[model samples]
Target: MVRLTPAQLWRFVKRFEARVLIGLVLATGALWTFLNLAEEMSEGEIDAVDRRLILMLRNPADPSDPIGSRNVEEAVRDITALGGTALVVVITVVSVLAFLFHKKRIHALVMAGAVLAAWASSDLSKMLYGRPRPDLVPHEAYVYSASFPSGHSTMSTAAFLTLAMLVASLEPRRRSKALAYVLAALVVVGVGFSRVYLGVHWPSDVLGGWCLGALWALVGWIVLRALHAPTRGS
Candidate 1:
């Protein structure tokens, strides 16, 4: 049996890790480009697909009627609340405080900054697009903001995914890291879907939000990793 030297092992590990990071960077870039293209094409117009998808959740006979029963509507509202501004703020604050308590100041700061950036970006996009919320069906949830990009979708994706990345970084086991990412993906998808089901956001709006939010989260993760890297003199 041949034994590999420390230098050889280190080089192999570095190559593997680099490949993973490069993949993430490419995925983020691709999503951002796709979002820009979508915005350019659909800028003052609602696509037929977006209109049909939103309407599918409504009764054909009565456009105002939500497809589900009262219980389902209530359940959807509760799910949507998970991505609401109030809840996202609370979760981000609690996570930051916990990170600070553990003396991980960099992580805490990155998480807070990422979420704030996501919120600001969402607002700016809404202002730039000035797209109105869906009026085809009565909204199942309260909304007062312009709806080009779903704030709930963006904020929830940024917050949950940022937290997931932080947690996954701390896990020494690969399986644990995978689970963290899986849970993050579930939360992001669920929150985005809730917006459409509630009849307050078009499907395209949610897609744009998801793309933006995921890009933000990945950028934050990259920044945090760079910040935490060891100095050469050390």
Candidate 2:
């Protein structure tokens, strides 16, 4: 087994951090490009698009529906199930496990902090947007919160992506890391789509959720990496 010396680990982290920073910047630029384009569209155009999408998602029976019919009940059940809430619960469990079971205080703190920051950002955005959930469909499941961005989508992206990233970091083989990434993408997309299918959020709402979620996850990841890295001159 090859154990990296403290200096070697620190140097590796520096290189990793620089690469991550560059990736994060590029992602932010892409998100800004999307939002700018969205902002540039005429109000009428935007409204027309939103209305059409909402009607298709929420009022599936509308004659012009493009996405086709879906069983809202099943979608509601799936969206509101374990996976939707798993991020928060799992993060708590992992933090406890890392601290108590694994006896790694720093690692536990890093995970706990990252997860909590994501949760806080999601909650804040929900409050700020205060957008109403879709009323076109008979809400088979119940929720009473603002819905500009689906919390499920936001939290799922934050949690699943972060964990997958951690797994990717720990795994040596590229194949294993790629598998973890694919699985993570599936979970994030699945959860986000479930929100729309269940008539709980607008498509734009989910898009915003993904954007904010990814941004915050990147921020959290950077913080975690810095905290986890070996100290200088140790």
Candidate 3:
């Protein structure tokens, strides 16, 4: 019989609990504060920043105008248009299709569940706060939604990040895995920034979206891991 060294045995044992414990502790604490911090200083600061960000994110009326806002507006327009949505939709469809065809029902279920959950959370927050989008800038687009927290930002982050996590787990090589994570991060960040650049979302709205999205994604990951862990062992 082959013998296992103490160090190797210890490493395997440590993997069983250490990472999970650390991830849970940190994620729980951060999400708790993100959800709870309602003190005057924090809320006031968030409000102020949100207002300032809206002002800063607005596009200049003239494309030729010399300003720091030109690039931002272009980026926003490019991303807020159907092109961005198309890209995201394609990615989501592809992922779901792949999972379904491959018979990975669990993956498909989690992806769908996470997206819906994130959107629901975002809509609930909007209704609860009933905050309107900034009116300082001339409305570039037809605006009808409650805009305390950006739903696009939140949902996009949740979906792309979750996809990234799943891809990272499935990929075989370190380089490929890292690339997947980076691309996922870029998608989430790009979507959030696109909302701000469109003048549809206050900076605070995007911030809250990221916080909520990340927290939701983390919770989903934990649940998915728990569900899969036993299957892997079996």
Candidate 4:
């Protein structure tokens, strides 16, 4: 290894510290957005607009129907299934087990913990807000829970994004890392949009879920990165 002067080492540490702080900055921004959305929703300031946006995705002639061919609608349902609770849970379990089997116990724990925390937070938010599902249109999917923030959107974004980042960190190539992130993002977007398209959630509900879920994933990723960082004076 090339030994560096103390000054050079200090500069490199400073840069690394700055990069670490970027994660915190992203988490803070997402938190602020979620809080603002929650406040506006609680004040009844955005629901009307949210409903209007959701309605825009429906057939004008028949509000109960989605604006797409039958096959396209089926395709969307399949896409939405990627965010369903059963699938997300299965994915998380597989990932956690993979880590454990590889003797990466810390990674296993972190993965499981982050997904459970996301679920708990989403459930708590739903109970606290007690927001009703949209009544303006017929729901295309079965829903049995309160709908301030779509749980599927929240859970899927949190779990999938966390898993993606964890896997990306294991990849040595930058191209693979970018692809992982891109695919995760697409999944998140598709799930959030599907919630609105299915008419089970208002647009703001999906937006709120996306914000909160992204915040959790960002914070979790930061923690994971810190845990993997080289200890000082090693």
lDDT of 4 by residue, 1-234 (tens): 999999988776664465468988998998899889988998999978987898899888889989989998999999899889899999999999998887777667767887887788889999999999999999999999999778888888898898887777677777888898999999999999998999888888888888878888887777766666322111
TM-scores for every candidate against the unseen true structure? 0.84, 0.73, 0.76, 0.89
Runs of candidate 1 with Cα error greater than 4 angstroms are 1-24, 27-31, 37-46, 229-234
**How far out, in Å, is residue 176 in model 3?**
1.3
The reply for model 4, stretches above 4 Å from the true place, is 1-16, 229-234
Worst 10 residues of 3 by lDDT: 225-234
Kindly give the stretch of ten consecutive residues in candidate 1 with the minimal lDDT sum. Answer: 225-234
lDDT of 3 by residue, 25-120 (tens): 756874675466323223555767666666655434742232356575576666655223356567667887897887777777777777778778
lDDT of 1 by residue, 14-116 (tens): 6436635874776578477646746663564557778889888888998888888999888888888888899999999999999889888888887999899
Q: In candidate 2, how many Å is residue 213 off?
A: 1.5
Residue 191: error of model 3 in Å? 1.7
> Cα RMSD for candidate 4?
5.3
| Displacement of the residue 154 alpha carbon in candidate 2, Å | 0.8
Clash counts for all predictions: 0, 0, 0, 0
lDDT of 2 by residue, 99-175 (tens): 44645455455556656666787678677556677666555456788875667776777776766666565567888
